[model samples]
Target chain A: MDGVLKIFKFELHNLSRSKWVILYAVFYFIITYGLFQFESSQSRVVVSLMNTTLLFIPLVSVVFGTMYLYHSREFIELLLSQPIQRTTIFWGLYMGITIPLSLGFVLGVGIPSVAYGMNKLEDVKVLGGLLTMGVFLTSIFVAFAFLLSIRHDDKMKGLGFSILVWFFFGVLYDALILTGSFVFADYPLEKAMLFLNFLNPIDIARTFLLLQLDISALMGYTGAVFSKFFGGWMGMTTALGVLVMWTLVPLLVALRIFRSKDF
Target chain B: MKSVINILLFSCFVLPLHAGEITVHPGDNLAAAITLAHAGDTILIRKGVYSGVGIVINKPLSLVGTGWPIIDGEGKGEIFTVMSDRVSFEGLEIAHAGLSYIKENAAIKVRDVRYCTIRNNRFRDNFFAIYVSNSHHSVIEDNLIFATVKRNTSTSGNGIHVWKSDSIRIVRNDITGHRDGIYFEFVREALISDNRSEDNLRYGLHFMFSDHCRYVRNTFRGNSSGVAVMYSKYVEMTENVFENNWGPASYGIMLKDINDSHIRGNRFANNTIGIFAEGCSRSMIERNDFADNGWALKIMANCDDNKIFKNNFIGNSFDVSTNSTFSYNTFENNYWSNYTGYDLDRDGIGDVPYRPVRLFSWITEHQPASLFLLRSFFVTVLDLAEAMIPVLTPAKLMDARPSMRRIL
Candidate 1:
């Protein structure tokens, strides 16, 4: 535990000192500020932020995470030489990357929105949900980066695979879902839609955005589905659980991979 | 006892000689006074709580209250049953006609009468506030009706309900918490204006089989559903505000099986669907503003020959969603907020026709659960691609002359 903390603290210090992290924060701040300039309504701003963050966060996290691992191969080797536990180093690296990214996001989006002042409780909830979605996307993609790195030893291959995964989630998966819905148009697919959304973190985040931005549109659906998906606590908790699982399952698999990999 | 004897003696002798105003205090026998009073005479009621009067007017009479006297039903029965023509009720707080599934216990029920006037009254906690049935040329105006139901249910009654009536003028009323704010059935030639109906259990204004009606300057907000005009003909709805009527199957105006009507200059906002038209034809829906609704218009496949023009569609989730592959109605000269075409020719109309219906909208209409993919990246790409080349949505549904600015 102490070894993990030490590694985590050191990696965090190093990443915080890096210029890329600062740039990330600045980019997010600009995006959020521009959104506020265009729309004074906090909910609308939050919705736009959800859209931008969903697109950018996954792409940035995956590419950056893979690049960071490949570039720091030597440093990781040096840490491996130490007697520190592999689990400790794994946790340390994970926390180091995730915390800075989340902080950058939270501070960047949070400062402008908090400055705007959330008068409605609903706005505050949506803002919180948006930030949570941002952080979860970061963790999930970073874990995917680890999985890609561990699975592919070559740097170029690892980077290519990272980009491919990002594109697949961003475009192809949703296309397939849309087509699947169309192809199976004759069947009732409400439960299937819910299940499919649970399978993709990006889909889950998009669902979260729609839960607020298009509530009336959602209500235009049948009554039972809306009540089950949005009007009750069960749906929210399930969505949150799926997101947590998306982060955890990847990280755990990456940890298992790290444990047995031969450098 | 002595006062009662003197009143009886006066009623036996003096009442027969002349028809005059009858003044009754709180403790006086209001029923005996009504019996002794002549037709065309006014019963002047003093300020106090009177319950279970069960007053029935069989002749033309006026019940005028001073200082706003209370006529409570005590949750048992209907308050007034006017059976005669030329009857009027004024300046009273009538209340507590309780729930009865059998009899519609209204504060005032004008039945089988003509030329009745129900004005300047406040009604509370009644099953039906003012029920005008089988009447003609009646005027119901300047009244406030409120009920205690938190939401719309069939058990709750309407604020002002008219059935089998004609030439009725319902104006300047504020109603809430009832099943429907105003309801008309089998009525004709009615004018409903300047009413504020909000937070009702059901529709703010619901009419069926009523013809030649004109509704103007009314505000219907936060109801379970908004105004529903159905099976009516030659109706004119102008300058009304339908807002915050949000729920599944809720619409600002649900027009069903109607013909030859004019819906002009209305503002519809924050509704699930601004206009849901089915089996409607020959209607002119013009110069209306639709903002922030789920779907601005859901014109079904069954509708034909309707003209939708000069409307401003702003910030709606979907501009138009229909179950039709072919556009039956004319959509022209509307200003859509999502229109991105350029006007290099400097014409107010866009050089390119704007397609209001998206392929995704059509898809969602076909499969509702697919709406989970709304605003997703892939969906955006699909929409963008579809916009560049129209494939699934109706081809002829495009607005041939899209406005460069809002149609003010």
Candidate 2:
């Protein structure tokens, strides 16, 4: 446990010094403020931030995290040659990168959102949910990046792969389901569509934020179908649990992958 | 001059006139004609292509055009303006105004008026068809607005644009070949119903920050995107038909940050994606029919606790696509074309819980290209395995209160 703490502190200090985390947070802050100022509607400002943060926070967090892992490859090698076990090093690095950057992420989005929420105290629940969501989602990306970094020492390739994964999960997953549904139009596949939503992490994020916004009606038929099948507390908890899975399962797989990998 | 004599006759009520009548000829000034007209007067333009400037009204007046009178801005100035209470413009064809993205230049502009009506006008080759700003209690219905759509650049013009307006009724208008069919920004308490919107480069209906509005019985067909409603509340969308909106990322209705609304009795068919619901909550979706969509509904997993009940799900390839399970929602009494559950006891409700989502959805959500591995035996086996074991998909995402019979 002492060794794990040492690894954790080392990685945390390394992540804090990286310029990319600061850049990412700064850009996020600018875009959030710009959108808020442009649209005077409070609800709209919150929604845009919610969607943008979900996409950007994860993307930037993963990139910086993966790059950090690659940059410190020689240091990791030296440490591995020393007394530390692989799991301790991996967990330490994961916690180190996630904790500091997660703090930065909160400050970047939370300050403006809190300021906005001051006027609209009714939206405290939404603001809390958004902040919590950003933190967990960032952890997911950070963990995924650490796992990817373990495979390749090349920062560009690792970053590119992370982006591709993000794109597939973020944008293209929904497109494929839609395209396949069209390609096989004759098939009676209503139930299949419900099962298909769990494929993308962004969808899960969207589900939480959208439910909070209270505008699921515009989702039309399938949203209606989902509301029918999973419109209760049990259904919502299950949906949220799936979101946690989107974060945890990948991290776990990445952890396991890192555990067996040779430096 | 004969025009001056006619103007005097028009003002003196010597010529035959009803309600309020003013005539605009090439030789006469439109502003002068408007100045002579009183409250509840009709400004009639003769059958000639006149290239005079815009006409502004400050009273309850009707601007009637006879024989498709053409109003050209002459490339030097603005086209027209209606700035009074209960102002109406009809039966005129307007074209050729300078495009100004900053200053909204329209063929007809209605500003800061109450109870104004703009109908039965044909807009061709104009920067903006009908632009209403800071106006209220107005009706813009049954106008044909066609603007040039370019694939090269984005234009800020719309067929019918309403901004910061309230209690406006827009209905039965055929808007096509424009940047947007109908657009509302920061508008409230309006009703947009029974409009046939088609073949626009952008969304059929694009409105943001507009609240307490109702879009009912409108056919949003064959646009780049059917309709996009973002960041609003208490909006009722019922009995609208969303069809034939196809693209790489197209949907019948794209809703973002909408809350506490009613989406009922709508028909979604033959769109790339029927309805894309993101970041919405506590909405009541009931009695809508989903048929032949590429994907019926794309529910992003963050959405929760919204009731989806009594809807007919027919022939969609993938009914509900999300990254989460159906845990925090209630899906009951919905008729799924793919529901294989049996009503064992002769009651209308199904005997067992129906899992609307399949294991295939979970696989595709994580590994999208695995979609190319579609129809393989591995997909089926994996799906069956997951269904039997229930590992990755949420355990409680099933519909325990499944109805045996179709509600609709």
Whole-model Cα lDDT per candidate? 0.87, 0.74
Residue B130 of model 2: what lDDT?
86
Off by over 4 Å in 1: A1-13, A16-18, A38-46, A114-119, A223-227, B1-19, B98-103, B149-154, B345-349, B404-408
Candidate 1: residue pairs that collide? B152-B201
DockQ result, candidate 2 = 0.01
lDDT of 1 by residue, A1-263 (tens): 78878887888888878778888999989988887886634555665787789899999999999998888888888999898888888998888888888889989988888777754687777788888889999999999998898788999999999999999998899899988988998899988888888888998888876777777677775423744585569888888888899899988999999988898
Q: How does model 1 fare in lDDT?
A: 0.87
> For model 2, how does the per-residue alpha-carbon lDDT over B43-96 read when each residue is reduced to its tens digit?
888877877566667778888888998888754445878777898888888876
Q: Pick the candidate with the highest TM-score.
A: 1
Candidate 2 chain B, run of 10 with poorest lDDT = B369-378
At residue A122, candidate 1 shows an lDDT of: 75
lDDT of 2: 0.74
Question: What C-alpha lDDT, on a 0 to 100 scale, does residue A137 get in candidate 1?
Answer: 95
Q: Write the per-residue lDDT of candidate 1 for residues B120-219, one digit (tens) a residue.
A: 9999988899999999999998998998755338678989999999999999999999999999999999999999999998899999999999999999
Alpha-carbon interface RMSD for all candidates, in angstroms? 2.1, 12.6
Chain A only: list TM-scores of all candidates.
Answer: 0.95, 0.86
